[model samples]
Target chain A: MAGKDDDVKVLGVVVSPFAIRVRIALNIKGVSYEYVEEDIFNKSELLLTSNPVHKKVPVLIHGGKPISESLVIVQYVDEVWAAAPSVLPADPYDRAVARFWAAYVDNNVSTVLYTVLAMAMSPKLFDEQLLMFPGMAGVLFAATEEERAAKAEETLAALAQLEKAFAECAGGKAFFGGDSIGYVDLALGSNLHWFEALRRLFGVALLDAGKTPLLAAWAKRFVEAEAAKGVVPDAGVAVELGKKLQARAAAASTAA
Target chain B: MAGKDDDVKVLGVVVSPFAIRVRIALNIKGVSYEYVEEDIFNKSELLLTSNPVHKKVPVLIHGGKPISESLVIVQYVDEVWAAAPSVLPADPYDRAVARFWAAYVDNNVSTVLYTVLAMAMSPKLFDEQLLMFPGMAGVLFAATEEERAAKAEETLAALAQLEKAFAECAGGKAFFGGDSIGYVDLALGSNLHWFEALRRLFGVALLDAGKTPLLAAWAKRFVEAEAAKGVVPDAGVAVELGKKLQARAAAASTAA
Candidate 1:
């Protein structure tokens, strides 16, 4: 067991939004921790040992015991330092709603964002690969030109729902939970940075300022917020990295 | 706004484990709620209007306002009651761990269980469908002789991780949280009835009592616990339903 007296430590890759989630949460709560950047391509022994199961970055170590998973770490940090700026709702029901949306973003929105980015950056290769995958391939790489058009319609429908959810949740508020950013905001806000970069790169807006004004405003406010100012990665860097990742994925598809 | 004095009502389908999650949480909290079983085939106007977005069941209506999603509802029930049998841990870190596992089950295990059951009941049809959804299809269709011989190694490897997680979290305890059942148990225990039936139906023994004695014991102890007795659906009924659902799914695949 890690001793309580030892300094808190966070292990993460520099550019991952997942890692940013923990950093934002910890910073908001005013908890100071040592940040150890890991090269995911060549993982350090400490990172590997700390999160042996997932072998993923964004491992939080307090004392010596480690906790993996960004959302899990956020909840752990909230509990361990309850007196500070609370991230979760004090009421259980509200907390559940907060958690539910957070989970929804992780499961649904993330995948959509990934697919959209893949399609935008390398339309030809993405289409070819989609024909190979079973479930999503049909929808992602429709056989007939008509089928492709229909699939795009379906994709838009799903995106619209997500945009609506953001509007309803963040209506007239600086954050999802209202004026002060909460866990839900931190979770959702981290993704928005990447989406903003993707939108810039792709030149097709999913979360238009006009269509989802609240979400757009919330993103701006969140990025400008005191807690987020210095911690979040630069949008330009993320866009450049996303383009490289997309190009690499396209290359891999061609090779296969 | 609905007054606090009005009776709480839950709109959901009768046999859904998701709906039962809310029921169990509410019952444990000793909160009185009117159960309105919805015909999923013919969703009510209230159900449609209240949960306009998802239009799903297990909508918790309090003071006229509706809250959707079972996990979200459970949290709402916990908040409204705020006393009696507490479903979540008092400490935030432990509560986060419970939520993490619960979310894991919601996002992954439940989907896997569904896929496994679909495969067991209709191997041929499932194989054909697997051709369409390659990523997950490999696991489902691998039950066949030629495929099983090739894929069983990977399947077992994945299952082992789940077994290890269960052992680490719930071993030597009546439930995952020690002494008594908590959120993890309730979130997970509701699904055990379905899995138990699947075990008898498939006869493959995924939850081998010898291999995962703690999980087996926890399942037994959980379903028998006072919180679970009235809340969970009958195992016998679940077995019958499982057979029918499998048959229907198989037939549907054949028709397609």
Candidate 2:
């Protein structure tokens, strides 16, 4: 049997915001674990077996038992490492609010932003297989520049809503969890690099300082947190990765 | 300020599986609350204010504070009413597994199943405004019988995966929570009536006795539970509602 320390393993890709979420939570909880980088294009057998349903990365294998999904993994980490600082709020209502926003981040904000990023980077990636989320394609992806611009507008609207949520949740605090980073913080914060990458490379401003001042300020503070040190990737690195992936996708399309 | 019992109120529509999930949880916890059935077509001011983000059904209001989303509400109910028979598994690993399955139910099984039902009943609902889920249109909805059959096949495949999960989670127990209804049970169980309605009216067998025996059997046991008595609406009534909505949709389309 593996020891307590060695038993914890995270199967993830460094570039993925979902994978980074698990790392951030583990870092905050002060839990050390082995990180196995998966080739997302050609997934590892371990990852495939670990998450047969989704076959996605960021599977936290604890005591030989695999737990998939970033949010679920974060909560699992918080629960198992009970001694560490809590990821979710101690209060039930507050926890629910956190859960709600985290879900909003996933369903409304992150998916739209990421889909738009994918569209911007590699239009070829919009093919059937790459668009894993079926229903969101219409609302998210665009064929023409006009439609893409409209989608970007929708992204801004979502960010504006998140800005409001942050105001309510933060209640005049540094982080969404007040002094320290909490569930909602990690949920949106994990994608900070992607937001930066979008703005720098594509001129797509998701977290605008002028529009969503609180969230914009929150993003700056979030990246500087001790737990965020190595977990959150550089915006430059993200842009490079996006370019590499887009080239590969383009090549694949040409070959086909 | 409202008293303990009176403070709790649910803003929901009767036919929505999502709303039914909240009622089931509250019922299981033995918490008393006033149920406000919202007209989904013309959402009330309270419903709009309560759930401005989603503007959907199943908002749990406790002491003037509102929490939206069915799964989030179930967890909130479990946390706040900690003394009551736990809705989620006591073990964190078990809890994570349950959460994963519940998410799968929402993403994979329920959405596909429900969307197909909507397509079958009201084809006109496929219009831009009603097709709220844009990308999913390609994979989920079908204008032709052949395409719809393929989508149904996909739903069945998803169910097969859930069947495997049930075997792992149940481990010869009656419920997903092991001898009692837990989070996953409620998550999937809320759609029992709809599943039945689909099967009876459209011959869309989602939870077939032959294919997924365990889940089919589990559905029976789920509806029989005391918590499911009033919460799980009648399959016949669901069929009637589907017919009424279909007629209305057809009329609107013709009029347009």
Candidate 3:
């Protein structure tokens, strides 16, 4: 096993959800590492050099070799520090389920969040922004129109599944996985902020407290946890950013 | 490790890229199992009962628990028969990189292939199809237009990295990681058949012999190998299917 102080550094942007997922995972495991903030507008030399292929942030550099991709990085961190609180489930079936949902959240919810963010930031591209939803909706729901409408009728079905899984795993505990927060929580929690922000920005709610009470409560509980408390963006700030993004979207559309 | 059995059943459609990936992996490892062909048009009750969440094929039923998803099924197979040729590398870092690429291929390449398949199947929906290309191109190249163009100019640069990795690992051998094909090769090799079909379907090509000589050669070498020979689709059949898919795409677009 690599030593604790083997120059473990994370290159990331403060506002990035991808970066935050890694940060939360590392924090929960109590792994000590240096954090290097990268400016997306003007990426650092290290960021570019480290992740030459992707050249994106949230590159975890250990000893010299850099690992890119947020989900991949999380798995690497878990495997490298196996003795620490394991992020993945021990059983193969359970682990596969975890991965399936993680991939689902990444492909579906994350894409939706990006669409919402881009729309909020630049509403002038409303038609273009609307296209993003169909892909996401296709994944969340079934491919057919009836299936999509059914899924919309039960809007929070996917989120509800996560909440049930969380409750079962949490067992009345604070975190998603018993005592400490696990990988699933970390991935889902960051999206909670975006969901809240999107609701305010669009004035169309997706995950309501009534519809998905468990998930809504879990989101609140996750954010309020000690590990995540100060790290997350507040609802007010998120709303303000959401409004700014919407205004920008409108302006861009008008200009176009 | 679970005992090997002739009774081991795999429910999958031969044409499915995801199913074929697992099929190739199983054949590579010399794992014996019964293959149950699935009809995607009208899914069997067993598939629905087995994978209620996804309701997709490539479901490997061993003893009882059905494993869905090609990658997950690959891992499960590897775990069950510990003595069989290991698909994953033993070293943590190498394994991480291999896993990273496998996940990358699963997430990105698979999606691109779908879009490409869609485009080939229906030329009339070309405009709708083109919309999907930007995201795929962005990942393959760079984010911005200028950067993306530069990246395309250096397309072989990324392919070179893959080629070098394969060559070094294979050591002038047929398989990726030596005498027997390993996980990385299976993850990559599965795509070769589809690429071959696509080349014939569409006159324009991506993985040319001149541009990616090693990879192009590897594709031919892989299909001819004893392990991969049985599973690869015949050229005649693929062409017919491609034409049918293209016809379907045209009809759907016309209706739209």
Candidate 4:
């Protein structure tokens, strides 16, 4: 096992909201780490070896041992740092609630949004490939125009649920857990930048201010927060990247 | 908010492995609690109000405040009890690993098994109804005989992964997290009761001793462990319940 003095490195991609989760966690905990960008389309050798299971981004390598899965990494950061502004609540019940919602964000918000984006950018990939995989596969498939519209409507419904949660969970606080941004906040907030880009790229409105005022405000506060400002990828960069991926996917399908 | 002195009530079903999770948690913690079995077909007002989102069983009512989701409830029990034998490891990486596997068990093992079971008992429920829902819905679906057999093969493959995990993660320990049964253990262990019934009901072996000796051994040890005694529902009971549910579902479908 590597010693305590060993390095801390994060393998990530700017477009991936999951990677942003780790970046935000590290930033909030005030822990310094090397952030290495990975080409998700063609994963690096290090990423492949580091996270052999998912082979996905947001792998945090601390002292040579890599930890994958964004929430798992976030929890690890909170525990290892063991500092103030704890990511999860000190109370067990509170922590349970926090964990539930974070899982909810992953299940309801993140995965669904990714499916929607995949449908828009790479419909063939969405229907023929990604849908067949296990766990949240092809959940929001859009094989037809009507199907696409239905999925878009579903996204709005999902956002409405989150908006309801913000009203109920926040209870007059600025953040979900009160005072400062906590676990659920980071879990959801970290994805907002990339989600914003998706919104613009797809010409869809998910979290409309009129529909979800609280969530709209919360997203603004989260992205603009001092800790998150420099860490999160800019929306413009995200939009450009999305367009590039779209063009490339189209070309790949055409060539095939 | 209810005070600390309020009653601890667990709303669960006798056959649900998730309810077993809460039972094991409370049993391990040595916390006194009342168990209220819910009629899932007609959820109680209390259960519905407690967990308005899922309306599922395994709702932990502590001091009248309800906490839904089994894993969340288990974590809460470990934290509130906060005594000897920590539910997860102290090391951040270890905890992350445990969390990941626990999530994996939920994502892969539990969901897949439930889908298979639903397919067997109520094909209509599994197809038209469950398929319509979002988030972990219609995943692991098998409409035809060939599809079901393939899914069974997939289940075996999933168990093999768990067996591999036991070897890699445990490093010759009796449990996943080491000396005592930890978070991941409970995450998978609690399901053994329901799984046992499924094995007998479906006439398939997921944790075959010849194939996954480690997992097979772990299942025996988990069910027979003194802490798990009486907390986990009996396989006999589960089988009976499964049969009754299948009959009822068949009758309902015929009526429709």
Winning model by lDDT: 2
Give TM per candidate.
Answer: 0.79, 0.88, 0.80, 0.85
Q: Write the per-residue lDDT of candidate 4 for residues B105-187, one digit (tens) a residue.
A: 88667663354344444555444343222212122233345644555676677678788889988899888968678888888
The candidate with the higher DockQ, 1 or 2, is: 2
Chain A TM-score values, per prediction:
0.79, 0.85, 0.75, 0.83
Query: How do the candidates rank by DockQ, highest first?
Result: 2, 4, 3, 1
Candidate lDDT scores, in order, read 0.65, 0.77, 0.64, 0.71
**What RMSD does each model have against the real structure?**
5.9, 4.5, 5.9, 4.8
Give the TM-score (0 to 1) of chain B in model 1.
0.76
User: Candidate 1 residues A1-256, lDDT tens each?
Assistant: 2333258899975557678889888888787789998865577899889877567768888777788888889889887877778888786556766776776566444442334434544565454445333222233234455754554444345456656665666566667776788877877677655666655764435456776666767778888888877777876866766666556555655654
Model 3 C-alpha lDDT per residue in residues A59-86, reported as the tens digit of each score:
8888787888888888888888778788
Better of 1 and 2 by TM-score: 2
1 or 3, greater by lDDT: 1
Better of 2 and 3 by TM-score: 2
Q: Report the C-alpha lDDT of model 1 over B11-56, residue by residue, as the tens digit.
A: 9755567777887787776667798988654678999898775677
Candidate 2 lDDT at B221 equals: 97
Against the native chain B, what TM-score does each candidate's chain B reach?
0.76, 0.85, 0.76, 0.83
Query: Runs in model 4 with CA error above 4 Å?
Result: A1-6, A112-141, A240-256, B1-6, B112-141, B240-256
Global CA lDDT computed for model 3: 0.64
Which 10-residue window of candidate 2 chain B scores lowest in summed lDDT? Answer: B131-140
- Number of clashes in model 2? 6
